[model samples]
Target: MGYLFGPVLSRRLGLSMGVDLLKYKTCNLDCVYCELGRTACLTSCRDRFVPRQKVIREIELRRAEPFDHLTFAGSGEPTLSLDLGEIVSRAKELVNSPVAVITNSTLLSSPSVRKEVSAADVVLPSLDAVSEKAFQSINRPASGLLAADMIEGLKEFRKEYSGEIWLEVMLVKGINDEEAEEIARAAESTEPDRIQLNTVVRTPAEPVEPLSEEEMRRMLEIFPGAELIPDWDWCVPDRIRDRLMELLMARPGTLEEISCHLKIDGSDAIKYCKIMENDGLISRRLHGGKLYFHAIDES
Candidate 1:
């Protein structure tokens, strides 16, 4: 499970099994709001960071696992992996689940890079800024990288690829929030299937600010058809939490079992379970090929 990580409950992609193509924190952009701390190996150069055959072998081994998407994400930008296209193609052959690639939209400027990324069934690309100053302040890109070129690259990508494109816009308060309208216009110009809005929800590398939900709602007017995808509120209701804890205390339950017994949606079950797990209220285990959560006996 070195290259392959969770079938984690992603808000947008559902239960996505992640594929890490690059090394830890190796990215072209040292984004101010990155959750993986700072970029350790910062470069725009694409190379074979991991063994292509090894990644494919791992994918072959895990192809039967239940997941919605075999997502190319985690650690750093997936586009930075030179073997991305071959790996993606191989994964498609080995797995029934749709393939996805999440990128920062910097390397899309290169036609070859765009071609490599287009192999995925779905592409989730981010555009946080349209102005160079905003881009530099938020993304802290490698030298010679321009926001305008990124936008143009996205536009070009739209023209070339027929696959589903869910363009994401990360808006940090005061950093790139001011240019929301411009970013939205550029995003619209790309003609993506969907435009998703996100903000700093995790503990970021830098002390950045996230916009309020009300502000995000206001932005919907600016962006027209864009959808806000941040986990804005991390609260689970007292009743649900109590019931879930009681259920887990009695006996361990897989996500499906918890959802069925509680008469809650599967996604809600995952959200509650994750929050409880983080709070040390419950613990996770894998038994008979299914993930289960049981209450921790703190006595």
Candidate 2:
């Protein structure tokens, strides 16, 4: 499962199976808020970094889970894989689940890259900055990757591609958040199906903190209709995934507490808890050696 991970649950895409294309940290940008830390490859070249047939073989092995989407994302930007189109096409042929790809929008400038990714059912590209200065500071993209070109690529992509484009904007307090108006302008120009605003929630490569919920609310004022993405932990759901979310929406719990709250056996409680944990739906913390499970903010 080197290239494949999870039939994880996400608020945006339910029961997703993640497919990583690029090797760990092989990216076009060394983003300040990257959860996976700094880029080791920091490349713009498109090649078969990993064997295409091998990845397809991996997918064929894990076909039982009814994943909502076969998401092309990994330790880095998916567009880095030159064989992305073939991968997307083959995955669709192998599985009934719709294919999706989460790209950083860095390689959209390449016609081949854009054409390759269009095979996906949905494309989620990001725009954290419309201005070059902001782009350099926040994303630190590869040399010669202009902000203007990336923006234009997205705009062109909007015209050519028919799939749903949900543009993501990741905010850091003093970095990109201060330029919300510019980000909105980019969003308007791109005209995606919807805009999703997000902030860092986990340990980052750089020293930065996620914005407060209140701050995110203020940001909504600028983006107008954009939705704020909830910070989700990996949840391992049991047989009843919906019930886990419903119960956890009220409050977080330990397996014992969740068992009591849902009136289930303690043995069954731990089993469900472990499932939800693996699914990335809920996060756990240890207190006095007891593991407590808590659902992340789904709003």
Candidate 3:
């Protein structure tokens, strides 16, 4: 699993199989709220950090695994990989699942990068700030990266890419949170299929603060139709949780199987699974071309 990890339960993308293309912590931006800590290599240059064939071979091997998306999201910005386009193309050819790329939106300014990333069925790009001050305070981008250029690049990308674009806005409390209106206007200009709003839920690289759930709710008024992605309360009902754990302890089951057995709707089943997975109570595996969840053996 050097190149591939986790058909993990993602908050947004269900059962996402992650593809890491770059070395650990290799990114152009040192974002304050990044869960992976500081950027070890902060260069804007794109190079073949890992052997391309090895990565492709891993994807080829896992082609039969069930996942909602074959995601190209590395420990750092994925577009920084020189082999992104080719690998994305290869994944699309190799897997039945939709291909996705999660980018920091810094490199989207380059036409070459935009063209390469367009190969993905879905692109989740983040825009935290529109103003230079807020951008610098939040993203801490490389020497030459500009907020204006990032915005323009997203607009350009929207024109060329035919697939779904789910624009993400990572709002940090007292940082870029003030610029929500401006960011929302900019996000709307990109014509993304969905605008997803996220705040600091994971332990951040810096000791930043997350907005209250109420604050996030009010943000819906600002960015109409934008989906909130922050972990609020993060509680799965006790009855459902116990039942899921019991079921998984008996035998592994797919989402569909779990939904049918529990007599819960698909959405509720996924929501519960995601919460349990986050709490490390359960884990997922791909078997027989389907994703199955099982309780983690503490022993």
Candidate 4:
């Protein structure tokens, strides 16, 4: 699994098989909460960091569970790989699973990058800050980038791109937190399908404080369609749709929590949840501003 790692369970994409196109930490921004330590190769220039052929070959050789997605999400911004579009296209052609790319919105400013990444079925791009001050404090993006410009690019991406865009907002205490209103406004401007509210729960690169769960819940005011990614449980099993229903039978939980609990692929999890929801095996309710699904007979 040199280039491809895990049909790793994800809180978002579930049983996501990852593709690492660039060397570790080769990115344009040094986000304050990056789990992979610091950006070892911080440059904006794009090249064949790992030969596209190698990545494609690895994915072709991969043997695992029915992955929910073939993800281009490994160390650093995946869009920085020059052949990202080709890889995305080839992955789609090679596998039946939906392809996804998790990227920071910095490179979405480029039409070429957006065009390439648009090939994915889902694109999760980060928009952690709106104003320059907060952007610098949180993401510590490359020297030449601007937050305002990045927002514009994200809006533009929504225009031409047809895939589901799950915009990620990495909230940190005091930095982006103080400016939630502004960040929410920026998130609204992008018009993403889902606005994923995440925080620094994992060990951070910097000694930054994470936002309390209550603080994150308050974010619902501005982001009406937002959902919080919970502390997901790790368990991977086959027959994901059935497994998800079985888990819900024990206790009601949010969609992402189900993904985390079962280590199910996010795409496949959502698909199964929908089927279950529609078939009346499960039902949903709003509790504490979070959507919870439960067995229909549960009290």
Candidate 5:
């Protein structure tokens, strides 16, 4: 529960358990519509964000749980962690579930990073733009990244990675939505196993609106094999819920903050918090019109 989040039902991967490789807000891009809010450390450097041992240990411990996929995801970017490949290799040896990494594909240009992700069962990489200007406006990636280089990296990864590769395109109303043809062209270049069309379902760090369902369907048509995945699931395993509550109690968080940090939905986080409060496992405090949760014993 400390580094790992739920056995929550995911539309893409059923009963996915998450592993946070980097600290909160450590990422390469400060995306406009990120569910996790602003990026605090928006650098492209690959370093040890979380100690390697801790991540491996958590994966080992969580291996006993019932999860369909063991995902490398969290509040920040997973690919930014220098030891990502080793973590994926170690995790594969430790668990029987399919291993996955949800990456923004900014670091895929590096051969080492591509090699690391190749060990996983599936790699879900994001390609929201075809042109440099659109990429800059949509992802708002760190200073060093070039959309062309990132696309090249994805193309390279497809050749080296034998595992399934799913390309994720997050559609923001006025931004990337207008460039559906370009986006589809870019996706075709990568030749991913699946093209996943997604939209902003949670509150974003910046004020960005979600695209309409009709627009999403139109976007899907552009990519022949692509599918639209609307965010809606909320179920969490009882044991995983208990573990998540324990972690949240140790560190207080707002509903938005909790969902962002945990990579779960806001309503789901709120529901779990209420259940924990009713069970006398945790308590909440109202600060500046927003509720913050903490352990009852912390008082």
Candidate 6:
């Protein structure tokens, strides 16, 4: 399961198996609350960062196993992988499971990028801010990316893509939280299938706080088709669950990596892993002072 990670339960998508298309921490935005840590390659350029054939082969292998969805997500943004469309097409050929792409929506302005995601059953893109100041404060995108351009890209993608487009809005307290009206206006202009309201529930790159439930509900009200995803019990397949526990026991991973690999959300992944640790199935360790997990009895 080098490239394939989980069929873990997701709050948004059902049991999902993830495909990592890029190496770790390579992204266009240096979001303030990124759980995966600081962005190493802070650029918006698209390229074939990972070998396409290798990623395809991994997806093919994972498809042989039982899973609900085959998702394109990884340490970095999936759209940054230039051959993403090819990978999606190849994946569809190998499995009947629905294919999805989780992206930051930075590159959706490009016709080719939109076309790439057009084949997927679902495309979840992030729009943390509608204004330039809010964008910088919330997403902290690369130097050249403008909020206007990103919004236009989302608009263009909505017109071209027929799949279920879920607009992800990660709200950070005091920053983008107060701009729900602006975000709602922007989302209305895009006309997406759904608006997933999310907030930071784990350690962030910067010292940011999450919005209150009341604020979240108010924001959701502002956006017509929005839903607030709360942390809860997720359903993972028996075999996949066992394997996930085994993997976590071997090496601790950030919630983002686990979610990307497991095709689940970071918050949900943390909840499940915490339960496992509490039951003594695994133990937590600190490497370089960052928390990780490993199996108590690997034998």
The candidate that wins on TM-score is 3
lDDT of 2 at 165: 95
- TM per model? 0.88, 0.79, 0.91, 0.79, 0.77, 0.77
Candidate 2 per-residue C-alpha lDDT over 199-298 given as tens digits, one digit per residue, 9 for 90 to 100: 9886889998788889988988999999887554223445457777787877777666677877776545655665666667778675653456788766
lDDT of 2: 0.82
Taken over the whole model, the C-alpha lDDT of each candidate is 0.90, 0.82, 0.91, 0.83, 0.82, 0.79
Candidate 6 error regions (>4 Å): 232-299
lDDT accuracy of residue 180 in candidate 3: 94
What CA root-mean-square deviation does each model show from the true structure? Answer: 2.5, 8.3, 2.5, 9.3, 9.7, 8.5
Q: Give the CA lDDT, 0 to 100, for residue 123 in model 2.
A: 94
Local accuracy of candidate 6 as per-residue lDDT tens digits, 85-194? 99898998999889999999888878888898888989999999988999998888888888888899999998887889888889899888878889889987999998
Residues 1-299 of candidate 3: C-alpha lDDT, one tens digit per residue: 58999877776787789999999999999999999999999999998888999999999998887777899996899999999999999999999989999999989989999999999999999999999999999999999999999999999999999999999999999999999999999999989999999999988999999998999999999999999887684678898898989999999988988999989877667888888887899987767777788999797
**How many residue pairs collide in each prediction?**
0, 14, 0, 5, 0, 2
lDDT of 1 by residue, 1-299 (tens): 58999888787887789999988889999999999999999899889999999999999888877777899999998898999999998998999889999999998999999998988999999999988999999999988899999999999999999999999999899999998888988999989999999888999999999999999889999999888888866668999999998999899998889999999987788788878888899988767666788999888
Give the per-residue Cα lDDT of candidate 5 at 48: 90
lDDT of 5 by residue, 1-299 (tens): 38889865566775578998888889998889898999999899888977889878888776877666899998788988889899899999999989999999989999989988999999999988877888888888889799899999999999998899989998898888888888889888898999988998889989999987777777767777888776432345687576677677568876667678767775567566655666677776756534567777745
Q: Candidate 2 regions off by >4 Å?
A: 232-299
- Report the error of model 4 at residue 224, Å: 1.3
